[model samples]
Target: MCHTSGVSSERAAHLLRLSALFQAAPAADVQALAELARLRTLRRGDVLFHQGDAATHLYVVESGWLKVSKLAAHGQREVVLHLSGPRQMVSGVSVFVDNARYSASAAALEDAGVLTLSAEAVRHQTAQSPALAQAVIAHFAKRHVELLERFDDLLFSDLNARLARLLLEHAPPGTTLLLPTNSELAAHLNTVPELVSRKLGEFYRQGFISLERRTVRIVDEAALRSLGGP
Candidate 1:
């Protein structure tokens, strides 16, 4: 059972501030959408939805992190998706598709908050706003393109190269990068933690990088680039 009573007028107004979902929606449509949503908070390690569970609602993260993963045939869980930080839309594609069950399970990486809108409510709002419908379609299309790129990277790039690229892209603009834990880094890079740690050690020995706990400092950016090939 989920709670929906904490969403006051202020919180409801803040929910309407989600630009991604209601970018082109009219004021009335935004209000209606917000009204139809239920707010829920999740603690770290909480399972928001399990694989094959009915996908009744789409989620928007207001804060914290969520990881979407699926169990492989080998009895290991593989993280295929991640939503870190705020204002992320979760599992929106499944709402319009024929599949009712969740394709992957979503778990809280940290204490998080989310607003969930029923599939029927989303459909009703989209039906009333053509712009919203088009926006949603475009959002899904962009996500598909991103997934294709990830597939290409995994197929063609080596583990070290992939890890380097991920670090550069996600790292803040600074001299040192605060990398995730080895376990979390493994999931993000689609590999095992032991392998990731080994690669980091190799990089350190080669004088190309330095690792301190979860922080990774790129000592030689040029060498890092060379590992990724031309």
Candidate 2:
């Protein structure tokens, strides 16, 4: 279940202060949006909003993680696009575009807390605040670059290279990290779970990494880096 409630302006502004998106925004403008902010709490597996839903509110993650993904046109497949964590936008960029619907759905990856600001309220303030407007433009540009990078990775990078890069990103050499399941990994990699499992097994057999259940420790960082590329 999800719960929603109004939040104190101070609390909301404090959350905004923690995000780079609002860091350079004027204090008065931040307070204005903060006054309209609400708190939303979600349990693990709860859907924050569906794709194609009206983008009424912009969300900022306060705690835990959420998976932002899109379903295929036939509704038969899902591609995990991004993992949003604390202080990051959750289905937020879309809110800035006029008449935009959410292009992807967001679901809590774990018990999570999110701050919600009404889209109408935000746009109203944005028009009067050049600093806020500039910050939002920067944020959108950053996301656009990330989307292009992901497209490049998917189009040109082979699975071995992609998977190796993914592992290294989550757990650098000499560090052990609990990893998401193969299914989740597959969704992020835009592949099937069986293939993910097979590739992981191959990596283990090659002594590139040590796997204890889902926990992975890098044993050969040089080899993975070479395969993963720069």
Candidate 3:
């Protein structure tokens, strides 16, 4: 991890504006936050923060991707919770909670740039700005709805349907898509890598997809769409 002071006020403000939680914030509050923000760079695979770490700062991705994950209760497996890209937040929502710690670990999926802001400063600003508080509430409401949808999928959908949906999300018909490794996919799908590989092989044999290295090419969109369902 490396920190740089070169993030200009304009860039910082722009990044903040992109976040739904801060997009409606008062200009003065935004400016104040811009001044308090710093840029941090991460190498691929670098751990940004471990689960249970003090939530001292909120992170906003400026470029590349970050993976949010948590280990299983037995401590023998990890589950990928979310993947955040540019303009997305990693710990912004969690930082506002009293005596908060990160609920999950965050790591770089690729070389990335992130903006960091003091959680204390954000709390102070929110206290002084009603508009900021309203924005935070709206952000949480939206996140809640999304979580509900994900819960429904996990509860009702089978692994094959989930895998199909994942592939279709990343690739359109006849287009090759670069993907994370099998282990990463399994982690995201809440399955074992062997099962993921087996599913891919089945899809290949069925003429639904083709795999080369870490890339997959869709061969039968209709079949996958049917298998994946609505």
Candidate 4:
């Protein structure tokens, strides 16, 4: 179940700090932006917005996880773009560009807190604050570069290499990563679930990784790094 709620000053400011859009701004500015934002509680599977939906606000994940994805044409499949956790913005450039519409869809991966900033509010606040403006630009640039990297992988690399890279970058030596389900991983990798399962099994056989219920433990970082090489 989901609901909207508010928090006290200390907690609200803390939540804002988690977001890259406000992480480095002055305390006063973050507070000002927080004042204008409304808190939302998202239940697991809550659809925050859909591709082609009118761009109304920017959302920050204060807690829990959010999945960002794009549906394929003919509606036969989807490609996961991101799996965002705490302090991350469901940041899209739509609000800043012409005839704004989200290019991808986002949903709550679990119950979470989100802070929404209306486009108009941000425009006004940012007009009066250069710091906020610069932070926004930086955030946009980061997200844009990530998109470009995803494109490069999809266009130039093979599926096994992409999967290896995904696990390698996200998990460190001997660390167990809380991974998305096979299906979600497939979508993110722009492949099928069977391929993901098979490749993971191969990784296990190679002594490069170990898998359990919802977790993947890195066993050999060097081997994965080799397969994940740029």
Best by lDDT: 2
- Sorting all predicted structures by lDDT, with the top scorer first, yields 2, 3, 4, 1
Model 4 Cα lDDT, one tens digit per residue, 75-178: 78888887877777785467666458899998887677887877777677778888878887887788779879889989889987898888875666655567
User: Model 3: C-alpha RMSD to truth?
Assistant: 3.3
Q: Which of 3 and 4 is the better model by lDDT? A: 3
lDDT of 2 by residue, 1-230 (tens): 99999889999999998886887789999998898899999998899999999999999999877888898879998888877777887766777788899999999877889999888888889999888999878877887897898899988999999998877875767766555667777999988999999999999999999999877888999999999998
Each candidate structure's count of clashing pairs: 0, 0, 0, 0
User: How would you encode candidate 3's per-residue C-alpha lDDT over 145-188 as one tens digit per residue?
Assistant: 98898788878899899899878865667566556667878888
Better of 1 and 3 by TM-score: 3
TM-scores for candidates 1 onward, in order? 0.75, 0.81, 0.82, 0.82
Candidate 2 residue-wise lDDT at 68: 87
Judge candidate 4 against the unseen true structure and give its global Cα lDDT, from 0 to 1. Answer: 0.79
Candidate 4 local lDDT, residue 100:
85
The 0-to-1 C-alpha lDDT of every candidate, in the order given, reads 0.73, 0.86, 0.85, 0.79
- Screening candidate 4 with a backbone cut-off below 3 angstroms (N, C-alpha, C), the clashing residue pairs are none
Between prediction 1 and prediction 4, which has the larger lDDT? Answer: 4
Give the C-alpha miss distance for residue 62 in model 2, angstroms: 1.3
Q: Per-residue alpha-carbon lDDT of model 1 for 1-230, expressed as tens digits? A: 33354565456547656646556566667777777777889887788899889888888888766777777777576665554446667877778755578888888766788888888788877887887778777767777898898888887888988876765544423555555567777877778999998998998899877778766777777877777665
